[model samples]
Target: MYGPVCFLAPAGVDDPQRPSGGNRYDLELMRELGELGYPVKLTPVTGAWPRPSGADGRELSRLLEALPEGSTALWDGLIACGVPDIVQAASRRLRQVVIVHLPLADETGLDPQVARELDQAERHALHAANATVATSRWTAAQLTEHHGLPGVRVHVAPPGVCLAPSAPGTPSGGRHLLSVASLTPRKGHATLFAALGALPRELPWQLKIAGAQPDAAYAAHLHSLIAEAGLTDRVSILGPLAGAELDAAYAWADLLVHSPEKEPWGMVVQEALACGLPVYASDVGGVPEALGHAYFPGETAFERPGRLLPAGDSAAWAEALNEWMCELRLRDRLRTLAEQRQRTLPTWRSTALEVAMALGGFPSTPWHTELEAAPLATS
Candidate 1:
């Protein structure tokens, strides 16, 4: 039997209308833990996370104070990392663990001072936790190196992919490139537009960007950029697709293009690969790992499921995109590799089991030993 486990996260984490990688991971983990017979309790805290108001901080303090001593509580790093005092106080009584989706400081467009402050706060918060869980090995390494969290046992529990049938790729006339990510600065929509704009106008390509407009200003900027580059007819911003719409977007696309400036385990990359869609992504945090590829110091090998380009490098992106469009053989080669890789992606159950083992404090069950001893599933 496993003891009661509390999962504390921001409100609306499981809202399908506002789909996000972090939210999906949290929701799936909680559901799978319950299915695995763990007494899982999800506590949604309402506030502007990572920078909560005074009232929000007080509410969080009250929530943590109400928990009984020796309770195992898993705190989402978004809330925990920003408020070190509350987490530190709760650590004295509760057995707290932190699930860091990505380091708070790594967020794009933050002022240097604010980033430094967040970095310091996160370092302090991780130290307060009994154990820490990172969504990727790159993130775990960042926590240890950038945050100086050498003592923390940071376990890697990457998000899992739901295996899907191979997508019937785009028909022969024009290439359809799909990019699935929220319209935020970190997602690098600007760079994507710039790269596509630099490509020849005669190239047979159409871009479908499917994601929520989290930042209205950025969305407006992207629209203006597209118009300025005379790409208004070529690009479409399909907002927040889900269920059939999202599935169809994946199926209809010839290629998946993700140009995030920083991505800790790009979940969409895995999802696209699961559907046998070739990926071309930015070589950022944990993205190469998800693509089942590696980067050597001085080699430009394109033998994997997809290719990785330097983050924010519009010229490099344009060059790669041009090659992909002009070379039918290269496209077919990537598609074949993507389909072969789809068979090896991990399921949500495996991800949940790894997370359960990371949380610890469970009674000795037969699966406990197996779970603890099991290796993390490769991409």
Candidate 2:
């Protein structure tokens, strides 16, 4: 009797109509679920995720007023999460579910008040949901371990990726290494630059870092650092890589690297892997869980994050990059290994089934059982 459900997220950026990172992910799945015979609705936040708009209160009010008595509306990002004093009174009467993508606690540089607001709201969302899902066990553990929720109660649904099929050899042979991450401080682009500074010679490869320039001040810092490191000619800051732009970056890259300090679940890692490219991700959050040998084949899987100086050490990040760039045989071997791993990787069809299960009434069919029992028996 759960009627057609809705997936709510910060739909767009400041414009409210432009699609952002997680918004695209949520909408894509919503459409696929709808096509799979479930009536699915997408609700946008007044503005964007992490940046709640006054429109948020209005949107929640609209959802409450519009939904029929017993239907559910599932929220898709961190913004919709914190059911605080504001949201507690605002959304209390509604039937809701929350898919915890990443909590805001890791935004260590944000205002304390903002962090507290998120804390209060997310806890309440977790408490009130008909069900809440965590994209990784790491996140579920954080909630359960800190918030006192039963870990088993929160659903764990691994993410899925859709990569454009590419002819690997021709596309990946160009002279560039690609790293995709936001402009946030935690993403560690500066470290990669510093690491590159230490190389004896600038290899023929150039490094392209893509994502929106988050804050102007941070962008200024990166610009200064790159100039100081003498990398203006070798490193390019390509703003907001999406769709064909991102595909072309992938199509022209020699390899991929991600060095984020606050990566909860890296979507780009999966995208790169699915594109038949290799990845060298920092050792943090769910990156290793997604790319380690357990889930990926031997060659394609990185040797987990090694002692690259420290987590945010730019000099150390450079060392890793330099070493990785020099190892052609290793990269080739891993690329082959990844192809084998793709054989077991989950597709959107399987991801949708898992999502359906988390929403309660989804059945325990063969698809469900297979997913329930699967995972790399990693130590």
Candidate 3:
């Protein structure tokens, strides 16, 4: 029998006040892996990850030292990527797998030197890992190209989405737009506001943003932009909402507007798709992959669930929003495609199985074969 898999992640992964794609992925993946009977043990670490304090580093080292020798453990890149020395030391005994959700240097608004330093640290940390798992094909490719890692060493295990009830879109044909991303520079809330500001007052659209304000300054800037654009009345900034509240936000919206400057794999994209909410997002990172091709069965002609505009381009975003708001036929077409894609979306079970296989080095185990043979269910 395969031994237990030790999964380590940030302790705040389940914090409703700090909801994020990475946190959601960690929570769902751990739960699903356990449900799949993988004998998984979760070790939630507390710290300012990717830049933990010295005390946090010592705690992590102690945890690693306590684990049985040769035990397999998967560490979230947020925790592992910034501390090469600690991880390298742990590598002597435990089998290490690091899951890179996003390259550390890809975060927006970092100083050039800080970005470079982070990039260097990440390269060292990844090299110390026995194998690396990237959450998207784009990320895996980026790691191989940017970090000089052998392509074979980095594996792809895209985040999966649970199918949600189809959103009952508004009668206004796509007037209620929703932006679900944290109030941070990387999420491009400021750029989204700029795009919305450029739209004509007669467009008859209202936006509701639902995300955590982890950065006080960025949140203030978003509010400032909203006021500057005279969108104060048209935009509602609701702080982080979880579970049914988040679901209601999706149900209440006609479209999901994602404006991230850098995203590795947008869990929100697939979540939006699962709810049958078409996404109009920046064409960066693995967003295009998450917005997978939508089409009728056996049909060669396919349509994207929504539009992909240039990242951080307010003009391009304005153009797409105008088109979505004014064109009823276009709105109908996109909605249909979104629903089609939703039906075929991958589930968390499959994602867990993929992670299991990756951790097991694609071993031909009995459970692996059984799970693979079982058809994935879509609600």
Candidate 4:
């Protein structure tokens, strides 16, 4: 709101325009913030390692070096997660705000070294910045638990889901089941595939998992699971279908399932709700935090949702799904709930308003009092 807003993120894909999950969130924020009449500029920087770059780290080094004095930058992506060293060298004096889309620690899961470095990097950036925002309360909690983030420093502000498609169809007897997520371990493709395999053969169902499979090992793992499950024909793993293709997939899907082990905030879950499609998801992360159990149930059937099962249990997932598949009355009710939940969340326009408010916002209550009085649990 003061100096120009610079959005810095990793450009993993060659195409400057193509952005993955974290980068996509940055783009959304940039667009919304611009609409709020704030000065915002998006820069897709090629950070060192992981992301492929022709200019390599030199491109990012030059840009960070060239940032004018006394400017404000809403640093996006995993600049803190991937390149911890840059946060100290580049962000000096600049009004830097660390936005946590996900906790870096949970991402590593097994790789403790990377996790430790990222955790420290993010903590350093958080300490250096004037302020911080966690897209979901789950992420906020994760940060506090793993990274010693000061309670007064972090606030929760969720991304908005526009009311695009007012009402979605439920997964009826002849309806389709869809899942959208990048091919990654945390996404829980293996669980979804295993559940599908466990389902009865004559269930008269087809599954389509949309999104790119960049990780070859993960892709192979999914393939092996699918083949073992005998879902070669019933399941189609189409990579990254956007535009008309994405549209058709949404329209065709009667029920959408998001089985990620942990997600800060699931864009796919929100997208499915917008399409008026009933959802079944794992109760592992911020996804349920964003879309409550009023629409998504736990253990048993939900009026608005068929059911929500625990994470990592393939048999339980399959049982819940199978039960929902047969109940036509439950399907219609679930659709109503999906549509209702979609309506409650803010649109991109209002999301900008929230961010803008945070940028220049003053304390109505004492920061310590406000945070300590109540633990944050909002999306």
TM-score of 3: 0.93
Among these predictions, the greatest TM-score belongs to 3
| Candidate 2 residue-wise lDDT, 252-297, digit = tens | 7656778887766777777777776667677777776666452334
Q: Write the per-residue lDDT of candidate 4 for residues 1-379, one digit (tens) a residue.
A: 3557777765553343232456556777788888767789777665463333446556666776777876666766366444545555565645566677876667735477766766676776665565567777777677656666655556566777655654334325335888888888888888888998888888888889887776788799888889998999989998877666877888888888888887888877777777777778887677776565444434344444335668778988888788778877777667767766666665766555555655653321222333543332111
Per-residue CA lDDT of candidate 1, range 1-379, in tens?
7888889999988776688889988988898989998898999999998989999999999988888888888888999999998888887888877899989999999999999999899999988777677888788778867765542256677888888889997655139899999999999988889999999989989999998887788889889999998899999998998889999999988899999999999999999999988899999999988888422224466456889999999999999999999888888778878887787777889878767766773321222112333222211
Model 3 residue pairs with clashes: none
Q: TM-score, each model?
A: 0.91, 0.83, 0.93, 0.86
CA displacement after TM-score superposition, residue 311 of candidate 4 (Å) = 1.4
Model 2, residue 20: displacement in angstroms? 5.0
- Global lDDT of each candidate: 0.84, 0.64, 0.84, 0.68
Across residues 156-200, which tens digit of lDDT does each residue of candidate 3 receive?
Answer: 778888788998978866889998898888898878888889988
Q: What range of 10 consecutive residues in model 3 has the weakest lDDT sum?
A: 370-379
Which residue pairs clash within candidate 1?
A: none
> In model 4, which range of ten residues has the least summed lDDT?
361-370
Candidate with better lDDT, 1 vs 4: 1
lDDT winner, 1 or 3: 3
lDDT of 3 at 25: 81
Query: Which ranges of candidate 1 are over 4 A from the true structure?
Result: 294-302, 361-379
Give candidate 3's root-mean-square deviation (CA, Å): 5.7
Ranking of all predicted structures according to TM-score, beginning with the best and ending with the worst: 3, 1, 4, 2
